[model samples]
Target: MLALPAESVSEADVIAGILALMRERTGYDFSSYRAQTIRRRIRNRMISVGIHTLTDYLVHLKSVETEALELLDRLTVKVSHFYRNAHTFDMLREEVLPGLYRRFGGPLRIWSVGCARGEEPYTLALLLEAAGIPGTVLATDIDEAALRAARRGIYLRDALRELPESLIGTGLEPVPGDERHVRVRPALRRRVHFQVHDVTGTALPLGTTDFHMISYRNVLIYLQREVQERTLLQMRAVLRDGGCLCLGEAEWPPPSVACSLSPLPQRSRLFEAIAAEPIA
Candidate 1:
């Protein structure tokens, strides 16, 4: 068997070292993440810390306590906003929710996996409330910091600028006297539950839920092919029959899974899930 080239072997070693340290300390296993993305993130961290070599960076990572974890969180790309993608929400409002209502009864259960800072799940809650759909939004992410922010349910006023007029209802209102900060309504916030969850793992605190819909969105793009497959399988296991799975416009599922992808008219990023008949 041929050995990997010297540079390739060295990069792999760095990634392996980082994965080992992260798993041991933070329980975030980036072992199955794509190498290029991981390497880029690590390199960016190194530059930010003024470290020249991977070895030196690893040493710094070891010596630092909470800061190392913060670095990792930053690299995870947690940037998100309410109604980040407008078309997708539009489709959910016009087509998907109605389909779910016709198929299932009231009180829909939605899991927004990797819901960073509560934006996506909160957006869903707002839309559902506007549509008069009785439902609960379970928002989850691996990062505790992000989860904390999500739980606060407070966001910058500008983050909501893109929300459709229908979803926003009246114009944005201040949180009493605070002009720069805005809080989602209590009624909307009441419908959401935020928790820390690592999608790559088997033990999701959420039980075997009959989820009517799931929105993983851009989260899977950070993972490697194998990790994506494993996560998708776990998601499929929890999803109810005939329920839908929504992904980011840039993300695509493996072709082996038998399900129909129906494109919504107004939404480019949204696709509806149709169950394939069992082949006996």
Candidate 2:
């Protein structure tokens, strides 16, 4: 029997070592993530890949680049749906987009940070179509695999479960001879671009373009608090004055960032960016 070191025997110690390895190899910090969540996810990944020990897994990460990518993908959560949180989409359609449409004088540039499999951006394309507005959506995610799938623009039949029926075929095409697959239409795909990015990194590409609205919904909750704050500042930099920034309903910005934003009257999760002394 191989004897592991007494110092590395405890589960806590093992998890810490694994985390350090992850940060070192990826350069994306996750030290502030919820410990229980990361622990559970990595443990699950280990078991699935037949990695019996955390120490062994650390060794595996160094040798296998694909495993590292898979580990990163597993660590991040990517739950999204078209017209997700329908009330929120309803708010965007009824109130938010029109407000931006007037301010930007027609074509609106929107950002969907941490966009997984391109649901939100494609949804935005459909919404803009319905509203009779020209718009472009830049969708980004940290997972390269997810971004590849997003670019492919095909989804399972069940993926449209929450989307309204009338809005379905307008921006998406069902795969021929296959009932289970749907592809985002060529015209709609043209309006959205997908990119790979790690939001925790210092060099996130928000482009030089000023965005009228950003849909960063649900992604920040998984990050460490400091990361969440840094992400807010990054988004603040590219957001045009008076642009909209929508976060998950359960989320809150760091106190310093909160001062620079004003909440929408009907929705507290949504904020309108306003000028404040920039944080360095």
Candidate 3:
């Protein structure tokens, strides 16, 4: 019988060691994620792989490169649907977008950060088409698999449950020879561009400065404080003056950047970027 190393090393230390190994090998850092979330995800991954002990899992993780990838994928939460939060989209369509459309003189440039499986960006695309606004959406996520699916523009029928009735037949069509799935219309797909991006990193895409709106919903709740602050600042830097920043209903900007964002009236999680002060 293999003696359990957890008998000597503390559970927290063992978990930390596993996270450090994941960071070293994958170049994706989960070290700063909420401790409980990280631990739970690690526990789930261990169970999936049939590992029974923390120390044992750490040893196995160190040996298997593929396990590292699996762990990384497990860390990303990809829960999204078309018009996931109806009220938020309702506010966007009714009040927010018209103002932006007027400000930009026609076409708008929007970015959907952490665009899981492409639902959110495609939703934005549908909104633009419905409103007769000529706009482009840049949908980015750190998960390559999610980006691939987003690019494919196909989804199962259940994914459209929250989608408004008016949008039916406008953006998505039933997949032929298959009753269970649908695909975004080609014109709608053309309006949104998908890319793989790491929000925790420093770089923003080229021409990011002119982005009129950025929807960064539901993603920040998983990050550590410092990372959340840094990521908010990055989004702030890329947002054009008076552009909108849409967050998940439960999320708020860290205190450090709160002063630079003003929430829209009667809107649950929408904020407008305050113009930066000029350096003397």
Candidate that would win on lDDT: 3
lDDT of 3 by residue, 6-65 (tens): 357887888889888987887777776888888788888888998888888998998887
Candidate 1 Cα misplacement greater than 4 A, ranges: 1-9, 169-173, 258-269, 277-280
Which pairs clash in model 1? none
lDDT of 1 by residue, 1-280 (tens): 1123446548568668877998888878877778878888887777777777776677788889875686677567887787777777777878888789888987999999999888899888887888788989898888998888888878888888778766664323468778888877788888889888888887865654878898989988989898898887677777777787888878877754434444445546554555653434
Cα lDDT, all candidates: 0.77, 0.82, 0.87
Model 2, range 1-280, lDDT digits (tens) per residue? 2235566377667777777777777666677676778877887888888877777887888788777667887888778878888888888888889889987876899988889988888998888987888988989887777888889989887888888898897888879999889999988988898887777777867463688988888888787778889889888888888999888888878877876788888854788988875555
Which regions of candidate 2 are displaced past 4 Å? 1-13, 20-29, 50-53, 59-65, 206-208, 277-280
Which candidate model has the greater lDDT, 1 or 2? 2
Two-way lDDT contest, 2 vs 3, winner: 3
Model 3 lowest lDDT segment of ten:
1-10
**Cα RMSDs, all models:** 3.9, 3.4, 3.1
TM-score of each: 0.89, 0.88, 0.92
**Which ten residues in a row are the worst by lDDT in model 1?**
1-10
